[model samples]
Target: MDRPLGPVPAHAALEALLPPTALLVPEPAPPWTAGWDERDENDGFRPDWLQVRRLVRELMPTPKSVTRERMAEAEKECGALGLDGLDGGEGDFATLWTTRTGAWLAEEIFEGLTRLCDVMDLEPRLRDFAEEYVRRGMTVEAARAFMLAQ
Candidate 1:
């Protein structure tokens, strides 16, 4: 009765905060064994980076992400056509996609994706999704299939 209150272990506190099914899942192997290294650089930048981004986002359920992605793509395409004449031009999109700079930007953005982000940069939802995957007994192999099936 005289024992003073004790601090909970950090892990215990985290576990308490998580859903009963929460888990710690490992990252899936990048789908393409070699990665998207051989992007077609001649034509207007293909925006292949968007493909990588899509891959990562779909792996996790961030909700509302689909709409945002659609919107971003629409905006970029619109800009490329210079329909708005404010942000993008066909040439602008072409330059961004077909050059080293564009690839670099795509690589950077792919890493910035919440699911694919560096551990230190992950948002709470992305981190939670990783944990939940483990909790749900998703193995790296299963994750690969899961991603492919989607």
Candidate 2:
């Protein structure tokens, strides 16, 4: 398992401006979508309210435009998947996507952003942060983290 670049290909990047329309799948609703809100927030569970409002407004950076778009897209995708009118505009979609596909979608978002950074000549940042961590060393864990620093 090798490539022209160190680990990730040169073309791999993130789409920081908009949520990926194609990435949303509308079938077989994620299993964990049920009772997601009832889970203990103290655990590693993705906070359901984080989607509606920033968890720590002062500490957390304002969401990018694409982040907003992603929320809208997730809502629409939910409706398309026969999940319309869920929770009446609360963080229902966020809960669903996060519980069911957050980790997976997060990886996809990270890879997409990496590719986007590459296209925008922001590869240096990716190399310093994401690629190096993924390539050089660290016990790779499936922990959820936002990859893009920009």
lDDT of each: 0.34, 0.37
* Residue lDDT tens for model 1, 35-54: 34453435343344445344
Estimate the lDDT of model 2: 0.37
Worst 10 residues of 1 by lDDT: 1-10
**Model 2, total clashes:** 12
The lowest-lDDT stretch of 10 consecutive residues in candidate 2 is: 137-146
* Tens-digit lDDT track of model 2 for 1-150: 012232243224322312333223332133343354555434555333334333212222333332545666656644554444343345455543333333333344455454454445544545444443333222112111324433
The residue ranges of model 2 lying beyond 4 angstroms of the native Cα positions read: 1-10, 14-34, 41-50, 53-106, 109-130, 133-150
Clashing pairs in 1: 23-131, 23-135, 45-97, 45-98
Candidate No. with top TM-score? 2
| Per-prediction CA RMSD (Å) | 15.8, 13.7
Cand. 1 Cα-lDDT: 0.34
